[model samples]
Target chain A: MILQLIDIGYLVAVVLFILGIKLMSHPESARKGNSIALAGMILAIVVSFFTPGLNNIALILTAIALGTVGGLYSAKTVQMTAMPQLVSFFNGMGGAAAALIGLVEYGDLPVDDIGKGSVLMASLVIGSVSFSGSLVAMGKLQGVIKDIRVNKILAFLVLGLAIALAVYVLLSGQPKPLLVYGLVALALIYGLLFVYPIGGADMPVVISLLNSLTGVTAATTGLLYDNKVMLMGGILVGSAGLLLTLLMAKAMNRSVSNILFTSFGTAAGPAGSGQDGD
Target chain B: MDAIINYISVNQQEFYIFILAVFVGIEVISKVPTVLHTPLMSGSNALSGVVIVGSIIVLGKTDPANYLALTLGFLAVLLATLNVVGGFAVTNRMLEMFKKKPGKK
Candidate 1:
């Protein structure tokens, strides 16, 4: 059957994704890895069209066309120094997609399945946070947003509120429209506040964290739909993002928590001081 | 609570796969030097654009009357597409700089 074939395609894609990541670790093979990953992505997309219940081909094509043009233009022109910001922007987009998928699928779920609802809620929260957080990160890197020093207490408080909202939404059982919107709004604000205090010097770590968030979001969506490829892709990206974040932190000799909670590159302290001249 | 437990049990295989991937992901990128970190980051950014598949699926399943889903799905696809295209393009541009010229020593 076509379904079996599609699943097989996804399996192949997953293998290629893993291989691509493995190859990308070295400078010598990184480009080849990228091409392999690209081919896998193309294969996945092509196979998804054959999935049962898929429709609205025109709209899909148009959206993809527009995105391709914009992505190509920006990627071709972005400066090396600004590459981090560009990555942030791309990560934000991925987060947005994950969140939007959750939103679209929200209405179709059964009302009694609290388990599924909770999973969806988690995806929405993480996806929204990553999306907005990456935007702020992009702004900071571009010097469009000032690195205003926020009190450490305020940042923690906001983060606490976001977590609380997530818990409330998950436990509420039924999808109250108001609660969903409120959770999304609070998450967005939390994301902004989360990255606001962190200085620009720590952007690589921040981007990595957000990337992991997107991966988590995607994986949750896969769980909701029981889609193997989505789940595999999400898990792969999530793990990769986590590894990258840790590696970047290690290279800088800073812990993940420190990078998240402490403000660097502020007028109060010079950058790279924590490294102890490593 | 029971429902949550059941759900987790149902997807036990997924959790196992997730754990395995985590270890592999960490090990694979362990030896990358600091100089290549940015490109690695950018390259992974493009990979994250895999979310486009989810968006396409969502949009494809929804009815046209569901304008909200349609609009959001469209935006999601567009944004994810941009991520993939731009991320890959920029990553390639960065890598190109490291390549030696044909006549260079």
Candidate 2:
């Protein structure tokens, strides 16, 4: 009976999420949509209490309280111009949460469950990459960090190394937790190098993509635990958000060179044209 | 190749869910006007905070004695919470600004 209720509750939350995204497409009903989605988030939290084996209740509740206070305060106080940075910073937190989930769960996985291992490896790498990458993107947006030249060749090599490490861990028939460690670290470095050189004007594009990546990372967790709310929410953000953004960019004929160069700023849209104060 | 197929065959429901989800995502978001992209992006960020559910699971299941896992899981809960709260709050703020003005069209 309890399981059935949990399932029903999650399905309701999924419907709310879809409604929320659909409503957000237009300016008129967007706020209502956001509220609906917020309700879904709250409902999901409430039902999570029904999940078995929940421990350290005090710690979990305290963390949620502290985080809520901090989030509310910052959201209320931040200026509009820095909205991108705030979004980037908050997105990084999401990534960190996903990566930390993989970290905490990694030790408990059976030594050779290849399927679970594959999912965990994915969440770990993408989450770590998005975590560090968002930080760099935020820093670049705030002009706290200078744009250093990046070599595409080197970036590709690091990505290759990270992928290779992940494959070895998942397929070696022997769990190498140490290599898993290397995989996370390498992905972080790759994220740094990958986003470090993109001009500030191009950040919205990159941020949207990273946001999509974070969503996919989140979905992998849902896949890991077979949770409908998590899986639906994550996949919705991952696929819908990304496809829409890419189609728009394509609509405007945004190209690879545009992503790597600042010239897209003058022509792309408000995000690029107005953002870079440089 | 067989191993890949074996994994998919065993987890066929998940694959179906994933594919159906991609289609749903694509369909729901296909028509957002460019003016609303920022709100949509930020609002979607809030949606991504649904990962909070995942963090809750990890924290709840983690043993209290394992300081490493417990601490990480605690941080995950905290971070995901902030993402949910802050993402929605900020999106609301932006949408308000974009809301129709009294005198303007």
Candidate 3:
């Protein structure tokens, strides 16, 4: 009975999320939409604690309290122009949380099923990448990491290695502790390098792409545990972030490939410029 | 063929829900101009904090004695909570300026 009620609560939360996103598209209703989404988050957070067998109550609350203080301090202190950096910083934290969840879940899960293994690995890889990539983006925005352009070849090599590690880990019947953690490390490195070379003008697109990656990671965790609310929330945010990325790219007269492959921003054309060769 | 059909039958509800939500996401995000991009991004950043549910579940269901899972879970909660709080707060700050603009003008 309690389980059913919790599911119903999740359903309500999902509805609020959808409605919130819908209203947010318009200028007139954006604030109301934000408030509704905030309410939905609160409802979901409150409902999770009500699960019957949930342990470590004190620990969870302690972490939440500490996090709240940290969040509010940063949010209050951030300058208006630094909004992009602040968003990237917070998004990175979410990606980290998702990656960490994937790590824990990967350990605790029974590994015979191929589907579960795939989801777990994908979650771990994507979460780590998003976390590190977003951090790089934040650093760039803050002018901390300046004028460092990584060789494109090196980034791709690292990405390839990360994929290789993931495939090997998945194919191995039992999960080896070393390989699993190593997979995460490689992914983190790739993520760091992935966003390192992109110029400031293009940071918006990178941030948007990373946001979607984090959203997808969250969804994978949701699927692994069969939580409808997490799945829906993750997918919704993922798609929204993606759309924003595409639209921004269009506004800048660049394709997604153009942004990723070439240093498009250094040669950023003036407004109403035609598409350059890919 | 039978296996494919069986799989779809089992996951039919999930698949339909997924597809429908994707459409809703596309529709809702269709017309956003660059002006609203910052608030919308910040707001969706808060939405990504939905992983907090997963973190809570992991921490809640874990054996308290397992140091590794406990530590990771604790950190996950800390980070996700921060994400949610920071994302929403930033979005609120961004949106508040819109209201102030008319009055100041």
Best by DockQ: 2
lDDT of each: 0.81, 0.85, 0.85
Candidate 1 structure quality by residue, lDDT tens digits, A1-278:
99999989989988888788777778788788888888888898899889798888899999999999999888887777887898899999888888878777777877577778878888888899999999999998998987767777786786677678767766666666676777778778878888987878788899989988887787888778777667877777788888889888988888888778666544356655455434
TM-score of 2: 0.92
Candidate 3 to native Cα RMSD, angstroms: 3.1
Residues A2-83 of candidate 3: C-alpha lDDT, one tens digit per residue: 8888998999999898888777766778889998998999999999998889999999999999999999999999999998
CAPRI-style quality class for the chain A–B interface of candidate 1:
medium
Q: Is candidate 1 or candidate 2 better by lDDT?
A: 2
Candidate 2's error at A45, in angstroms? 1.3
TM per model? 0.93, 0.92, 0.93
Measured with C-alpha atoms, the lDDT of residue A192 in candidate 1 is 89
Once fitted onto the true fold, the runs of candidate 2 whose alpha carbons sit more than 4 angstroms away are: A247-253, A260-278, B100-105
Inter-residue clash pairs, candidate 2: none
Worst 10 residues of 1 chain A by lDDT: A269-278
Interface RMSD of 1: 1.7
Ranked by DockQ, top first: 2, 1, 3
Per-candidate DockQ versus the true complex? 0.68, 0.75, 0.64
Candidate 1 residues B1-105, lDDT tens each? 888898888889877777787777677787887767777777877777877888888889889888888898898789879877887888788777656533321
Screening candidate 3 with a backbone cut-off below 3 angstroms (N, C-alpha, C), the clashing residue pairs are none
Q: Report candidate 3's fraction of native contacts.
A: 0.74
